[model samples]
Target: MTRYKMEEVLPLLEERVRRYTHNESTSVTYEKARQLMESLLYCLEEGENGNGMDIMAGEGDVKTAFTLGLARKKEKIKLAEELFEKIRKDFHSYHNHGYEETVMKGMPAFFLRYDIEFDGKNHLLTLDYPLFLEIEELTGIDLIYAYLKAARIEQDFLKHFPTLSVEEILRGFNGKYEEAYFNISEIVLYKALGCIMVKRPAGGLFMTEEDIMMLSKQLQERSKEELESKLQDALLSLDKELHLQSEVSEYFMTGLPKIVSNFLYYKKIKKVFLLFPKRKQKMKLQQKFQDGRVMEDEALRILIEKMQACESLEDRLYMVKENVRSLRDLKEILKECFWGDEFIQVFSLLSQEEVMVLKKEMKGRIAFGKGCIYKYLIKI
Candidate 1:
């Protein structure tokens, strides 16, 4: 969060690199060192201001900080040498206990440091300026080259398994499939089976003829329990997937009732009230009153009356203030009734005069020919 200027930091970076070069006995002197230092200084300054460098810095450990400072100067030769030594130590520890040892690779180390891909083309690696700018400050080499090398490895792997798709990546193998070395092909087939199982209803638990044929073909090389186990796994997965879909639909349904209530209240429109039946008797009651249609005003009046007659203190107060035309007049009346604290807490949004007028109006049923104010207020 602290702001730093590149102009201010660049001199500091140059001084530090010079000091490091003088203190450390290394034959890695070059003109590119200053450029690398500047690049790192730029990345750190930009990252600090833009909030992007923390990913590279991680938790600011001593090793990472040292690495970052060296990387800014583009001292790839030295950085690579250091990384190779660390990897060698790791491999040695594992091999000393009679474990099979594979040589500690330079490309993996480079990728872990810079998070870049390397293709076969060396030029492609060197030309990656963004990678250099972002990672050079924290690493010792040009990450662009390492990234290109990693990309080459990925490409080579993909070429061997040409039919791999994203769907195959999601279906992980259970214990049984582990023995077969379940590759991308089996993973894709399992995903297809899962999709088919999800399409079937709960009661229709039996596999379809097409699914059975496909399953039989896929499992022709495996045991019956493996196929059954996969089917069981698919069914369990479908249970959670289907429930999520249902919950999403239910969330949309909740909004519909609120929408219907608001439209009726604001637009002065009469509409049928949709009620959920709690029991079979309630369904019969709904059936008996299927033809009944309540006017909007009449329904509001009944609701208001029910609220007034209710024994609940909260319900009575909510009904009175929520329906009031003037909240100021209502507040004064609440004060007279020793309900000032509740009035201020609940109706802070309304003026005191408006609350007073609302209270006075509620006392009498003011008739105005066919259009009565009190009757309309009660209806509301």
Candidate 2:
């Protein structure tokens, strides 16, 4: 039982990633094996209960041994080793202070909130709670949601701002356009041959005389219908940038780093929960998380009905067991349903019986194998 260094693990990880990237198999086996090895690395560093050797022997022996064999005798081992070194460097570098606070080894708040300033001016718009929650779950980045929430709040405030006349806006640009029209919220200056032209937001957008002049000249030749179409596209783009997770942070780039941080955050969270292993505490945290992301009641009811509509009891049981976390949790949900008290009681009783049946099925399988029997006997 020897402790392995990061260098020792690099060859194994590289080989797995090489096969995965080359599409050696349609399955995700190599990727999963790589993740397993990475988890062992984390355990080795953290030494939660004991050294990596102990944890690998007690919990991860089978998978680690199998993946080590897969890494053996790889033809592209040199290339894989180079790739692994790059990955290792990038993973370490991405842990900036903000990333460390929000996603890496930190349990970020489910909701991100912050104030926003546009063109050095603050807007009164605020993100609605439901939309904030939606964004939170969508990006899976709590800090990004804060910025989006601020922008949305400002957007709502902008709805009340007086719309400047197109002529007045164009006057500063020194453009000759008499019959120009643009709503402040849905601003677009022109269209060309049924093609809508969009204005770029530069130097604080709508705040500059130059922007107005440029927009005025663009709209001077367009028919009202074409102008209207372009305006629609511009407004949609603005709304999307504000409401969706287009870009939340100026401090970080938008792609791979954010993705990698999010992946690492969840892995860290799982490791933390596993270390503590307190069922009640875990349940409470999970409940809070699920409340923000869970399906609506009507949707849940429809799903339950669909499961009930399955042809056989076994099908229904399997579906419920797979989808639902526990019998007790399902029972509580049924109690809150508007369907009826009788339905709730019946569901509770039937679900408990099904759970027992499923347990007995597992026990029956255990009876057929000595290794399974040994495991079960130790559990009791």
Against the true structure, what is each candidate's TM-score? Answer: 0.22, 0.16
Model 2: CA > 4 A from native = 1-120, 124-253, 261-358, 365-380
Runs of candidate 1 exceeding 4 Å displacement? 1-3, 23-31, 42-108, 111-209, 212-380
State each model's CA lDDT, in order.
0.35, 0.33
lDDT of 1 by residue, 141-200 (tens): 444334333323222222221121221121122222222222222232233333444353
Global lDDT of model 2: 0.33
lDDT of 2 by residue, 44-129 (tens): 33332333335445655433643342233122233333433333333321112332332222222322121110000111222222
TM-score of 2: 0.16
